[model samples]
Target: MKENILVIGGTGKTGRKVAHKLSKNGHLVRVGSRSGSPAFDWHKPEYWSLALQGMDKVYITFQPDLAVPGALNAIEALTKQAKNANIKKIVLLSGKGEREAELCEQVIIHSGIDYTIIRASWFNQNFSESFFLEPILEGFVALPQADIKVPYVDTEDISDVAVEALLNDKHNSKIYQLTGSRSLTFKEVINEISETTGRDIAFTPIAISAYTNMMKQQEVPDDFIWLVEYLFTEVLGNPNNSEITNDIEHVLGRKPKDISEYIKETAATGIWNS
Candidate 1:
């Protein structure tokens, strides 16, 4: 069935891919961003209704993440607005191991609308498309996580699952925990990138407190600093985050891309070339 769909944070990592896939599949896709028509801003609730207007389904990718402070309230209010707009289905892109992310999931679960939750592990694009890019370019990546391994899933897989959930009613009311086929520590990840790009990139694992202080010295925003600390200390610190899952293969009917392939593909783009 053809339906109008709105993708909040439509320009972001997973959101962009979701929006693109939906648009390519003959669905009406409205990208909800501050720069989009009827501009949607998470901080500005007033724009939400306008973005929701005439939309039958929504793919939600909250700014920053749902683990940050005030995210629960924002999610609750947005769910209310989505309901009021008579939106039939909602697919939320969520974090895998964060408690606050679960609270936000509850908001959508009880939002009086059919919903699908894609609780995702860390993204492979973090190295090529996000904060890690600059560090990778500089030939030295510093972080607080060393021993912990992450089952970093690809945004392409995430988008595939989200698109499937949006187009299929069978996925409604389902919670999919998506992860890569295997786990890799930060050291192994850097080594993979080094091998792919043939560059001598270094990995430095600092203490959590030391990382926090470095971010402070760099003048990173307090909220961003808090999120970094929370991710390293709370999420990455948990052993459960290292577990690989078959959810991606179940959803897409194929194995998720490995980090090696991701590194090879990303390195070809010259994003990590130093």
Candidate 2:
């Protein structure tokens, strides 16, 4: 049955992909952005009621990381509103190893609504659509840590799982720990990009202070810097995160896209052309 679905961060990377797939599948999709019809803004409580109106299901993608201050409160308030609006199902896009994100998950779980939690590792799109894009274009990627290995899941896979959970009842009330089929260090990823694009890409491992200083020099926003530091120090530092998962195959009935494939496809987009 086709249902009206609200994608909270519909303009964002994964959310946009999910919305596209759902729309293509013939479901009613209302993008919930500040500029959208019945505009929705997480920081603006007054904007939510109109967005949630007549929506039976919602895909919640919290902006600026749920680890930030006031995220839990915002999520709680949104879930409450979703419940009162008679929204029957919710799918949350969450981060791995984020305590505050888990708190938000708790709110959804106890909201008496069918909820599916997609706790994902770092996104491969970080290299394509985020901070790493500039470095890749320049052929030199510099970062704070060298020893950590991240199981970076592709946003395409994330969107697939999210679409399944939202449009089907089979995935209700489950936490999907999604990751890439393999773990890759920063150097490994850079080397893969170099091979795929036939360019000399280099990974420079620098001190945390140096990385922070470089970001400040580049005029990176304070919130983005905080999120970067949190990911590097706290999330990446955890050894348990380096393992792969079968959740992608379990959900989509196929192996998740490999990093090389991601690199090749993204490289063809000419982002790394120099």
Candidate 3:
């Protein structure tokens, strides 16, 4: 049964992959983004109804993060819009360790629409595609939470599970705490990437406060710094965050991609060195 799927933030790391896979699987995909027709912007709730129009299911990847302020309200309003649009299912990509993110998940769980929540660990792409990339490119990375082992999940696996949840009705109301098959600390993963690329990248472990101060010095946005601080202290600091989950295998019937694989493949893309 083919369906019309709207991927909000469709051009993003995980959303784009989900969109591509859905399209490849023959589902009609409408990319709901600021650039798309009937554009979807998080700040503008008015556009959401237009984007939700005519879509059967929606893959939602909230901007910044679910932990940020106003996210709960935005999610609540979006659920209403989705219901009005007659959207059948919604798959939300949420953070694994953040408590505030969990509060946002409550909105979807009770949204009265079929829903699946994927509580994901930190993404592997953070190193290759996002904030960590510049530091990696500089051959020097500095941060806090150096000792905590994070089961950093790949965006590929996250996308795969999200697509499966959307197409299959059995996943409705399921909250999958998605993590990798194993865990590694920031220092360990950086070492792997350095060895993989044969680059002499250095890793420094500082206090969370010190790390935030560094960001402040660099003029990183205050909200972003707050998020970083919250994640490093409140989220990553949680002991349960390091626990490995078989949710990916439980859904996809295979082991989640290891950070090593991400390092090798991402290194191949030269994003790390570039």
Candidate 4:
């Protein structure tokens, strides 16, 4: 059954992929962004109803992250609005192992509407598509994390799961913990990229305080700096976050993409060639 769907943050990493898949499958997709038609902005609740109006389902990928402050309230408000708009289902992109993210998930779980939570580990695209891209291009990656291995799930896998959840009722009320088949440390990640791209990229481990100070010196936004500190110290610091899950295989009947494959594919794009 084809339905009208709204993809919040539709231009973002996972949301863009999700919107593309849904649209290709003959579902009507409304991209919810500050620049989208009807203009949905998280900081501005008044814009939400216009975006939700007439949509049968919504795919929510919150900006920054749900782990940040004020995210819980925003999510709760949006869930209520979506429910009130009579949207039948919602698929939320969430973070794994973050307590605050879990609290936001609870909001949707009890929102009186059918919902699916795709709880994910770090995205592999952070190197190719996000803030880390510049560092990768500069031939050096500096961060506060070291010795810790991350499962680094691919956004393509995330998109596949999100599309499945939106189109199928079986996924409703389900929480899928998504991760790569194996864990890799930052050093390993850099080495793979260096080998794949034939570029001499280097990884530098720094203290959390030093990382924070550097970002502050660079005049990064305070909220973003806070989020970075929170993730480095709170999320990555936990050993349990490194556990791999078969939820991707369970949902799509296929193994998740590995980091090596991701490196090869991304390297071919020449994004890291610098």
Pairs in clash, predicted candidate 4: none
Candidate 2 stretches with Cα past 4 Å from truth are: none
* Residue-by-residue lDDT tens digits, candidate 2, 46-128: 77888999999999999888888789999999998998899999999998887778999999999999999999999999988
RMSD of 1: 0.8
Global Cα RMSD, each model: 0.8, 1.1, 0.9, 0.8
Tens digits of per-residue lDDT, candidate 3, 55-117, equal 999999998899999899999999999998998999999998788999989988888899999
Candidate ranking under lDDT, highest first, comes to: 4, 3, 1, 2
* Model 2 alpha-carbon miss at residue 85, Å: 0.4
Question: Using lDDT as the measure, which candidate wins?
Answer: 4
lDDT of each: 0.91, 0.90, 0.92, 0.93
Q: TM-score per candidate, in order?
A: 0.98, 0.97, 0.98, 0.98
Candidate 4 lDDT over 1-274, as tens digits, reads 7899999999999999999999999999999999999999999998799999999999999989999889999998999899889999999999988888999999999888999999999999998988889988999888878889999999999999999999999999999999999999988998899998888989998899998999999999999999989888889987779999999999999999999999999999888975
Clashing pairs in 2: none
Off by over 4 Å in 4: none
Clashes of 3: 0
> Candidate 1 on 1-274: residue-level lDDT in tens?
7779999989999889989988888899999999999999888998789999999999999879899989999999999999899999999999999989999999999888999999999999988888788888898888888889899999999999999999899999999999998998999999989988989999998899998998899999999999989998889987889988899888889999998899888888887774
